[model samples]
Target chain A: MTTPGRTTAEHTAADTLEGGPRRGRVRPGGRRGVPLPLLVPALAGLAFLLLPLIALLVRAPWRDLPEQLTGGEVWQALRLSLLCATAATALSLVVGVPLAWLLARTEFPGRGLVRALVTLPLVLPPVVGGVALLLALGRNGVVGQWLDSWFGITLPFTTAGVVLAETFVAMPFLVISVEGTLRAADPRYEEAAQTLGASRFTAFRRVTLPLIAPGVAAGSVLAWARALGEFGATITFAGNFPGRTQTMPLAVYLALQNDPAAAIALSLVLLAVSIAVLAGLRDRWMTAS
Target chain B: MTRSARRTRRTLQVAGAGAAALLALSACSSSGSDSGSADSGSSASSASSSPELSGTVTVFAAASLKESFTTLGKEFEKDHPGTEVTFNFGGSDTLAASITSGAPADVFAAASAKTMKIVTDAGDASGTPATFVRNQLEIATLPGNPDKIASLKDLTKSGLKVVLCDKTVPCGAAAQTALEASGLKLTPVSYEQDVKSALTKVELKEADAAVVYRTDVQAAGDKVEGVDFPESAEAVNDYPIALLKDAPNADAAQAFITLVKSAEGQKVLAEAGFMKP
Candidate 1:
């Protein structure tokens, strides 16, 4: 108890090898032969994680699945869900990638603040984002009021509003994910490409983009998923009207209010579509990696 | 392959046994024959049958009834000692949807009979619904009527940015009925989600005028001036109240319903620019 560090050489040696020796028998950090301390906590974590999904699956009405799936409105919402999500993904790509590059590569004042500000949408509640959007772009919104009087262009209660709302919520995911990857990637490849008689734009378009294509693709998947599930912002900003602003999540939520079976059917459709796309992309990613 | 093989074999046997034990453990975790859950279920049923209620009663009512309902809710709490009353005030359709999906609400007061029917049609409502109040559409405009909007006909003038409730909502549905009856082909800049949102546009002076409930205009106080339209007679919305069938505290639900349809409730409704039902 009075020793400054350790008592014996054997004890010191044992202490040094304790982690390695214990891990050697079980494969370090692997699930095999997890210590009781780790095993108990890991199991508890898994149950906590899977409980909600399990509840949904257990409560899902399986008998009316076919009838509910056949409704045209279900298909309409699904179609709109896919179309808007994809459009939102494309829009995020167009705007977010360049913004990511600027945040990652360029030097400017408020760079730290700008980076924080760009991710503001990520933390801002989606409903609040809708209100902020209204204040800025709504008919009587700060910018929107002028646009309304000058151009008579109304964005609310339309398909365009749905797209805008989704984009507002989703673009941050694309920006943040891609920006992380850009910071991790080597910038020398881009510089070298530029030195090889290529313009900065060409270097970025041809070389840097191809190099980070996987990260961009991954980011797009995340963004698309976020867009697919977007609800509050879309409904608040766009207003829910059938065949116009009402997308799949909104329909599913509304259906859950009246007919839970229909909600399950819609959820299954969204899940199937998302899984299929993700699995296809994941296969390509695994092989390429 | 001598001592190492024997030790590995023993380890393997231990691991496989451990995994099998883990699988069994998980299976046991989710087994359905637990007396605890069953006991809780029976107790819940008993609680429903004869409640020992000592909790706050939450009501989700239409926003149009905000002023009067808040007053009534306070009065209700004062009458029922040791009982607190909370309200989640919003659109009728929204409140109905919240109720249907097991929102912990004791009473639902809706602006329209149609929205209440959505809940009753689903068999989510407990008993027969009674009309508690009625509301009629009125033209909301900027203070002093800068646009010179007088009648429903004037709202249809070209260059007037008339905001209306979307047809999906009851307020919007009423507006449509009024417009149809009047045969006025009025095109609005936006069809808002609810009455309050529609009136907000007019209140903010963004829209030239909006067709919102008289109660909404009344609720807005001096922010906007309301013009009583002749066509309002064609589109009077009936307000309905009912206790949900699956209400956790049926006693509280019934009591709240009684309070809503009472003579005291009529006074509150009338004070909020609503007609006595």
Candidate 2:
């Protein structure tokens, strides 16, 4: 009745009740489910969601599509988007891990308050974040003027500025995801490793890292994707120009403003690539199983 | 262990992709290529028989023409019994994109000839575009012209924070030409996304000055001082109005264009600080 694992079992039961069990339909040999209420809404939502892309396909000027896609600038923008997204993810991980650990493990006086503040970026509008970034890191910003004069480094309208903006909007996703995984995970592994000859940091790196690797990986992917499609912050903070700050999202937006067909095609390409990457990751899970 | 980590990473990627799709689906809007004027109430059809315009005529005018267009829009409504006139005003680039994307519109009035050509190039314009109004740039400085920015050259003072529109929009393109003509290499603090935003930086005291149109400066009156610069003459932007090829309300569109070229329309345009073409 008082088994040590009972609380963990109850916690998981609650998680299942709250919808975690149904996150994926992974049951083996289950009838090709007939959940009409959920299925119909899901299908209709997907179609409604894809209608614009469908319209883009229908109205796309196929003859001229080659010219648009063949542009070197398109690839340049695409490359920039991928590069900045990954870089931003890396930056977020470098700083966000400790922040997440502090929230998850270490107790401070304002720990609860601090946790809420760290997740602020998730709710804050991306444009507001861009403005805040500008106010804080712009040429004449409170701290940026020093950076400008002492370093001769202006962040606005530059590639680095794009990374900064993306990071500002994307880091919260990583923090929250990692924090959730940390809470779900068993910290006893760390204690066991510490009971051995290893120090706390060593135990963390060898034992803790392996145990929460799933969570860390999940957070990184979240951060990466958030950074990838970032538009408002990148455009507002970095400004749009070819071969510089014009990431795929900015190009897609500017294209959408003038040419809807081109916008759709670009969107489709982005979707396809992101799906491929995500699916490739999914396969890794299968292999792990 | 690493594999399980990778597996979770994969799940994270899927979630990220799912969120992106959600964002795209939510924000996606058609390239509204059609002007809003395409709507024709039954009464609007009477204009064809005897030019006796009766019902409503919707005009999708450019953002710069807000005051003048509003005044003229009201006057046109009064002149034509039961003739309602509505306006869909925004950046010319955005308006053109909307029109091209299938925004139902009759008459198209754009801030610059270039944006009008985007429609014309698509063969959407019924005929050749005519320059209806001309607008020149003005140095929108803070109240009292605190920067003492008398000429174009003075804007390069290194310390002054200036704002200009992005090159994709007509206002920004014109500003670039003005700067090039004056041989000034002044870099603005930022290339604002739109004309109003560029002017707003000055109004909010965020920037020392802004390069905006005369009409924009007038629109923002008292909040900022409009300083005349000779360089603006070299890059006057011509406003163009036309009837689209897919004009659902062609008669109303033509009638509205006629009213805009009328004397009353000129008075309205002048009152809003538009220069004579």
Please give the fraction of native interface contacts (Cα pairs under 8 Å between A and B) kept by each candidate: 0.16, 0.14
**Model 1: per-residue Cα lDDT over A96-214, one tens digit each:** 99999999989999899999988898999998888777778877788887877899887876788888899999998999989998999999999998788899899889987887888
- TM-score of predicted structure 2, chain A: 0.83
Winner by lDDT: 1
Q: What is the DockQ of candidate 2?
A: 0.13
CA displacement after TM-score superposition, residue B138 of candidate 2 (Å): 3.5
Give one digit per residue, the lDDT tens place, for model 1 in B1-277.
3434655676676678778889998778756435435534554565588654334567889988888888987887777765567889987887887777778677888888888998898788888888988899999999888888889999989988788887767888899999999999987866676788788767666577999999888888889999998998999999888887766556655777788888988888888899976
10 residues in a row with least lDDT, candidate 2 chain B = B30-39
Among incorrect, acceptable, medium and high, the docking class of model 2 is incorrect
In model 2, the Cα lDDT at residue B150 comes to 94
Minimal lDDT window, size 10, model 2 chain A: A27-36
Candidate 2: clashing residue pairs, number: 21
As for candidate 2, its interface RMSD to one decimal place is: 10.2
